[model samples]
Target: MLQQRQDVINHLAETPFWSLIKFYMDDEIVATDRKKKSGMDLIKIIQCYDSKQQKFKFGDHEPKAITSEDVVEIFGLNNQGVELPNTDKSTKNMKDSFVKAYFAKQKIGKKNDIVEAYQKLVQDKTPEGAKATASIICVHLLQSLLFATFGTYIAWSFITICGALDQISKYNWAKGVTDYLFKRINKSKKKRKNGEESATINGCIALILYWICLHTNLLETISGRENMIPAIGRWDITKIHKAIRDIRVEEIEISGRIPCVEPNESIGRGIPCSEEPTEEHSNINQEECNDIPYPEQNNESSKKKENKTTGRKRKRTEVRVEEDQSITITEA
Candidate 1:
C-alpha cells in the first residue's frame, strides 16, 4: 500500500499540468488585466512520507499531519476501487468532437442554460459533486443535440472519462487529452475545406473544444466502443506521453494583448482630408503665392464706376415737333 502511494506521488511530480486540475483550488482566478496575473489553485500537497514516524509530512509547515484519507480524497478515489471512468483515448476523442460541434453552433443561450443546470444540480461546497454535475450536464446537452435519435447508451460510451478528474491518474488523463486534440486538429483540417457546412472548425474552436472535452463527459451510446476512429486504443500512449512531456504551466499562460479601440478622433471627428487645404499660405514663398492668382476676386474688385453714373445721366431732351399735319388738311 505504501509503495503504491509512493508511485502515485512520483507520477504526479513528473506531470505539472495535472496540478492545476487535481489540487484543492483555494481560489483560482484569471487576470482581468496585465497588472494582476492569474493565480494557480494550491493543491494540498503531501510532501513526503516519514517511514520512521509512520506518517506523511506536508513539508516545513506540518509534519506527520497528512493521512491516507486525505490522500484518497485528493486523488478522488471511490469507496469501491481505484478504477476511473473512460480515461482511455477514444473516450477523450468523443468528448472532443462533441465539444467542437456544440461550440460550432455557438448557441450562447444554450450554453448558459446548461451551466445554470450544473450550478443548480451540484452544490458549491462539494467540488467532486460539482465536477460530476458539470460533466453530466455537458454530456446530456451534447447527446440531446448531437445524437438525439441514436439513444443515451451510445453517448455514455463516448464520455466514459467524464468527471473522472478526482478518481483518474492525472498524468495519463492529460496525455489522452493531448492525443485527442492533436488528432482533432488533423481531422478538422480535412473537414474545414468544406467550410462550416462540413468542418466548422478553427483554432479558437479547437482550443475550447479540447478544454470542454476533458472537463465534460459526453458519450455516444453504441455497441462497439473499442472500434471508434481516433480511439486512444489505436494510438501508442508512450509516444503521446513523450511528445508532451515538456508542456508546463508557464506555457499554458496565454500571453496576449486585448484589442484596443482605434483612435476615433481621427476617424469620425476630423474634417475630410480632401476638403481641408493642407498647404499653408504663409509657408509658400512670396513669388509662388503671388503666382497663384484669384481671377474672380480681382475681376469683382476692379469693376468700372461708370455703371453707377449711367443710370442717373439718362437723356432728357425735349420732344421733337415732327408730322402733326393731319388736323390742318381736314380743316382745308
Candidate 2:
C-alpha cells in the first residue's frame, strides 16, 4: 500500500507538466544568480578598460584588481550566495577590534540575534534578490489562495513553488501529501463516495483555465514566460496544456460512470471503479479472483483468501519415493 502511494506520487510528480513547472520555478533562483554574475562580469570589464585608458595616456598606473568588496559594492554579490574570498581573514583584525568595542557598548549576547543582525547588515540590493524574494512571496500567496478556494489536490499543483518547501523539507512534505491524498481516494472508493473525485475534476477544470491564462498572447513573451530560458520559449507550455487536457478528459470520462454499491458487484478486481458496466461482463466477472485486500487483511492473508476463492490448482513438486515403493509421487 505504501509502495502504491509512492508510485502514484512519483507518477504525478514526474509527469512532464509538473516536472516542467518544477524546473521553471527552480530556475528562478538560478536565473537571478546568473543575472548578478553577468553584472559583475560587466563591472570587471569596465574596470579593466578604465585601467588600460589611464595607463595609455598618463604613463604608469596601478590597475585596480577586482575584489570581493568591489563585487559586493557594485553588484551586491554577497547576498546572492556568491563566495567572498578572504572576507573573514582580511577583516579579522578589524572584526576583533569592533567586537571588543561593541561588547563594551552593549550587554546583549544571543547567538541568533547576532546572526540576524549580521544578515541584515549584508542584505542584498541586487535585482536578483528582489526578484527571488518577490517570486517566492507571490507564488506562496497564490498557493494559499488556491488551497482556500479549491481542494487540497488542486492547490498541490503549486507545491513546487512554495518557498517553505526547501531541499531538506520537500521529501517529507511530498510523502505526507501523497499519503493524505491516497487516503482520501481510498476512503472515497470504500464508501462509494465521489467527493474526492469531484473535487479532483473541479481542480483539473481550474487548472485547465489557469493553463489557458498562461498560453494567451497577453501573458506570452513576458518575464515568467520568455525569461524561463532562451532556448525553450514558455517552457513548451502547449505540451503541458495537452497534458492538462488529457487529465481533464480522463476525469470527465471517469466521472461519467455510475457507481456500483453492491458488495458482490464486480467492481473489477485489481482496479477500483465506479459504474459504467462494460459490455464485457466475463472480464468483469474474472475480477472475482483479483488480489484486492479486505479492510483488515494484509497481503499474506489476502493472497491466501484469493487462493481459496480462485481455487486454481497449485503446481506439484516432485518427490522421490523409497526404493521399496519404487514409485515417484508429486506432492502438491
Candidate 3:
C-alpha cells in the first residue's frame, strides 16, 4: 500500500493538469482497472482513500470504504462519472485564435492613432517652426516607445538620454525666442521695401537671440517674470547648463553682425540702415573712389559719410594734389 501510494503521487506529479488538480483535491488511487463495472464505483474507491488519508496514513488507515452512492452525491455525476462534456480540441484552438485576433486588432488600432497624431503634429503651422521641431521630437519619441515596447530597456534608456541632451543643446527655451523673432520678422517684412532680405536678417537674429536666451540663463529669468510656456517639455534647470555649454559664442557674434540690432532695437530696425547702400549707390561709390586722384582720401571721405550717418565721430583728413594739365581739349 505504501508503494502504491508513492506510485500514485509520482503519477500525479508527472501529469501537468493532474498535479495542479491533485494539490487542491486530495485523493489516492486504490485500483487501476480500466474495465470498471461502474465509473461511480471506481470514484467511490478513490474517495474512500482520500477521506481516510486525511486523518491517517494510506497504509495504516482502516476506515469504512466509501460506496458508489457517496461518489454520485459528492461529484454530482451520473453512473458514468460524467458531468459536462469535455471541450473538443477544435473549440480550444478557436478560443486561442480569437484571443490572438482580438489582440492584433487592438495593436493595429493603437498604431493608427499614433500615426494620425504624428501626421497632425507635422501638418500644424500655427506656431511657425512648430511643425519642423515637432516632427523631430515625434521621431525620437516613436523610437523610444518602440525600444521600450520591444523590451530593449537599455537601448531605450540610451536613446532617451541622448534625445534629452539634444533637446537641451538645440531647443532649450527656444519657443519664446523663436516666436518673438517670427513676429518681428513678419512685422518688418510688412513695413520694409526689401521684405525677403529683412525677413532673412530677422531670422538670423532670431537664431542668435535663441542661443543667447538659452546660454545666458535669460530664459529662466523671462520664464519666471512672465510665466512663459516652456519649449518642448517641462522646464529643467540642467537644460540651461547644457545649453550654455553647447552654445558657440563666436557663431552668435557672426549672426549678431548679420542683423546688427542693439539689444533694445527690434529685428528689422537695422535693416533700413543697410538698405540705404543700394547696389546702384555701391557701384557709383566704387566708380567715384576709382576716379578720385587720391584713393586714400576718397576712402577716408567714404568712411566719414558712413560715420556721420551712423552718429559716430570721424577724423578730418588733409589731402594735397599736384595736377598736370594738357592743353589739348576735345569739345562735344
Among the numbered candidates, top TM-score falls to: 1
For model 1, how does the per-residue alpha-carbon lDDT over 1-332 read when each residue is reduced to its tens digit? Answer: 11223333343333322232222121111111111100011101111323345333332323432222322222222223332234122222334543342333432223333344444444433544445444544333222222221111222333443434333333333233323323333444444344533321111111221221122221111234233221221222111121112122122211211121233424222122122111121110011011111101001111221111101111212211111100000001
Off by over 4 Å in 3: 1-111, 115-212, 216-220, 223-332
The candidate with the higher lDDT, 2 or 3, is 3
Q: List the residue pairs that clash in candidate 3.
A: none
lDDT of each: 0.25, 0.24, 0.24
Q: What's the CA RMSD for each of the models?
A: 38.2, 29.2, 43.2
Give the per-residue lDDT of model 2 (tens digit) for 1-332: 21233332343243312332333233321110000001111111121223222211111333322222322222121222212122111221223332332222433322222233323322434543333333232232222211211221112223223322222123322222222323332332333333322211111111222222233221122245543421133422222222222222212111122122343544322122222212221110011111111110000111221121211221222422111111122223
The residue ranges of model 1 lying beyond 4 angstroms of the native Cα positions read 1-18, 21-117, 124-159, 163-167, 194-198, 202-332
Give the TM-score ranking, best first. Answer: 1, 2, 3
Give the range of the ten consecutive residues with the poorest summed lDDT in model 2.
30-39
Tell me the TM-score of model 1: 0.25
Lowest lDDT block of 10, candidate 1: 323-332
User: What lDDT, from 0 to 1, does candidate 3 have?
Assistant: 0.24
Task: Give residue 206's error in model 3 in angstroms.
Answer: 14
Q: Supply candidate 1's per-residue lDDT for 223.
A: 31
